[model samples]
Target: MVGAMSLRPRILSSFVGDRFLHSTPPLHQLFRYNPGSKHVTLQLSRTLSGLTNLLFNRRNLDELSNNKRKSLKPGKVSPRRPVPGHILRPPYVKSKQPPGIASGPEVHDEKGVEFMRASGRLAAQVLEYAGTLVKPGITTDEIDQAVHQMIIDNGAYPSPLGYGGFPKSVCTSVNECICHGIPDSRALEDGDIINIDVTVYLNGYHGDTSATFFCGDVDEEARQLVQVTKECLYKAILICAPGVDFKKIGKTIHDHADKYHYGVVRQFVGHGVGRAFHADPVILHFRNNDAGRMMLNQTFTIEPMLTIGSSNPLMWDDDWTVVTEDGSLSAQFEHTILITQDGAEILTQC
Candidate 1:
């Protein structure tokens, strides 16, 4: 799971007869038509009014129709699944409290690097297996069950299970959900998109990664959003090396997402993952000038969240689930990487 930055909740309300709202067309007419596909693809034109924009601090939703598909509803979360007694668990499991970001970079020696690679490979393998079960009728809870079994079968603990009170072993974010979506009993439908985040703890190290998968036949616009979100992650990774300014990651991701007019989520960020679930040097996905530098042999994750509509997030009552305020689709991709002498090595690859 990606770590979240502290944020204040904002009130959401639309004022009728506002100049900006009046000037904009209805949600249905705001999309750009593609002659090849019957579906209309939305392109954000302007942000909401000044007052509302400042209050929400997100793009104008003038282009998004409030009457889009039904908003995602929370389903009943299953009882917590048990792990085998023989499997070693992370320290946080016993505390039942969130172990906040540890205060240091995860720079590793040669032996530590080997351990990191082992955990990362396990995480990637579990995630790959979880993707194949993303069909129309399967519940996210079922996917969690499979992932949990796979992780323990390999003698590793599922990292998200007890951290910060997360109920499930993995995170299943569908459609508008930005991140940290708890796996539940809701069955996916055709055209729905889901992001499964998998992390594993092995030999005192942690590996984290995630990717969005199409449930079935997805629309062209949603497909483009997922594709660009992935490109944003790789493009950001390409620029990482020893002595590079960390701010360059934000610029690289923000610049590419701009070409497709996708909104980059700002609150959640990637972080150093090794001995701790979340570690030092918070990695921001949007444009910023934060002061930090990459060091050789250091490790961290670079997951980027991109949206088709407003990047503003509304948390579900469950507290673990986060969704787009406008109910538009959001997609994310993540990978744990090690900064090498020349470039970064992707630790979480199958």
Candidate 2:
């Protein structure tokens, strides 16, 4: 019977074995029994013997020991590092101050943290108001107008307007545009996705917040990207407690994005925002775990830009607007955060 017969064996070179199309290599020769031959019966008997029995034998495989994962759970991270991002106690801007004046090493001394916190709050309030205008048929310019007036009404300047000479009151990125989306004449359409990034300087403090919203009838991919991107931001935020390292924040975010196969923007990073707007700590949100650490009372934002395709981004000629290179839709959410004694607190939460 076929089951009792010995299977033939063949040898293949490395290159031929690596080639996938040809399932089995061509055999140079074949064995056969000649009835006229003197030892034909003996040869037939030998051929009938199963090769597996001739070799080791047949056996059922147990669960693979080689397939086991190294660890069933994530490991604990070391608390201390050789180089950690400095978190100031009182919080101050990282600009040149008079030589004699000491901004506390761990925290800035001159009340700059308070100002930064205030700015972040104002930015959050502006974003919350701006989000209300995100409906179909509304021109981005009108949204810009509302944001401009809102900042002015609050008696604070819109940081994006005239920032490096930018023209809009806030950034209104749509669809493929990743960051610094310009507020312009384009009208909102059904199924359109947009990100509104707002930063305001109120009473000398900087508050920044951003959220991606749907215009009317958005697609599944865009909606999921926005939802997951927002979640990744929160995941990174939750890890922003005092004594936590900066590199780990990106590590957590990148791991989450990897699970969804979303692209992680690499060019732009979260920064220290207190007195001068963007300051000292440059927070990079990717797995390279070397950015630094968070100390008590230190403050910053962790905004992750998750993409549907390529991670590379482009900037518009206004020298302000940024977009994705592949034209795939992108989404982002940001919140100014404060590191507290026990854990990190989101200053712009809500």
Candidate 3:
């Protein structure tokens, strides 16, 4: 079972407006229901309270909508553009593509390995460029626009554009958001931590990578969380080798995170990335007993999401963005790696 964290519900009473109360009935008039019952009941008072609650809830909802609109300014959907004819697109982008095109991990031959390497390099480069654009006051939508252009300029296709109907080219997860954050108009503020995930398709192969970045100066606790999360990823990666048990990766990650009092996200696990954006032997980031073994030429990703509070995540209503259940800060790092003759190669290294 996935871990559950305590959540601190945000009270938005401050956002309530007087307009919601204008139609509400007065307290005396609200008490119209019968109060007498053989079973001894306060039906009238209960009815009055229910009416009052209904109005208050309506007001709260209005305030929430207004606050969301105000906080996210200049947010716009990314425009669809044409890809170069020579560029190879994932099967999902092709009309009437076969379903099995995206499946389990497959071993790559010499030429296929080279294609994977090129795609990995481009993904890493795009992520590095996106990191440079991180700063206070910039909306995530702006970052998405820049990343979209960068991927296209490099003669590649952004893998996430239409995969599973995802709207953006890159994922920009901020603060409490754990992963798959859809870029929006929310302007980043000082001390905010964000993760920029980039995946590009080149020469019929896919490369994926992501890292948590700080916006301006962050607090000591947040900084440590990001640092430890990064360490968890590397520690897991260090154990990758031909014949190594896949379970060891999660064990290492869990052990390191436990020492720091951080929570490891279990809902989402890393996976093979190459011809398909996601495939198998599923890579878990917490303790597990999976029997899969690493093999040479097998390429996969190792990404660990660590949370400052509960590791349990609650999905946003959009069905994509994942946030900590407790609304605490979370950080993640990812890299595509290839098992080699002796050890492993970090294909997505910048």
Q: Please list the C-alpha lDDT of all candidates, in the order they appear.
A: 0.78, 0.60, 0.71
- For each candidate in turn, the TM-score is 0.84, 0.68, 0.76
lDDT of 2 by residue, 1-350 (tens): 01112122311110011011111212112222122221111111354334412331111123212322121111121121111123221122222221111122224443766765666777877888888999988877788788877877677777655443345667788887777666766777778888998877676566778899898888787899899999998888887777888888888888888777777765466766655455546566666534357877776777888887655555444434555554567798888888877787787855
Q: How would you encode candidate 3's per-residue C-alpha lDDT over 1-350 as one tens digit per residue?
A: 01121111110000010001111122112111111210111123567535523432122334334432112122455565456777777887753222222245657999989998999999999999999999999988889889988988888999877665567888888987878888887888888889999999988898999999999988787899999999998988889999999999999998998787677766466877788776666677767666779999999989998887665455554545766654677899999999999788999977
Q: Candidate 3: misplaced stretches above 4 Å?
A: 1-86, 94-103
lDDT, candidate 1, 1-350, per-residue tens: 11121121211101000001111123213323222221112334356333333443344566456535567899989999999988888888886556566668899999999999999999999999999999999999999999999999999999888876778999999999888888988999999999999999989899999999999898898899999999999999999999998889989998898887778776577888899887767777867667789999999999999888777666655556778877889999999999998899999999
- What TM-score does candidate 1 reach? 0.84
Candidate 2 residue spans exceeding 4 A from truth:
1-117
Q: For candidate 2, what is the TM-score?
A: 0.68
Clashing pairs in 3: none
Clashing pairs in 1: 47-60, 48-60
Residue 91 C-alpha lDDT in model 3: 82
Residue 291 of model 1 has an lDDT of 77
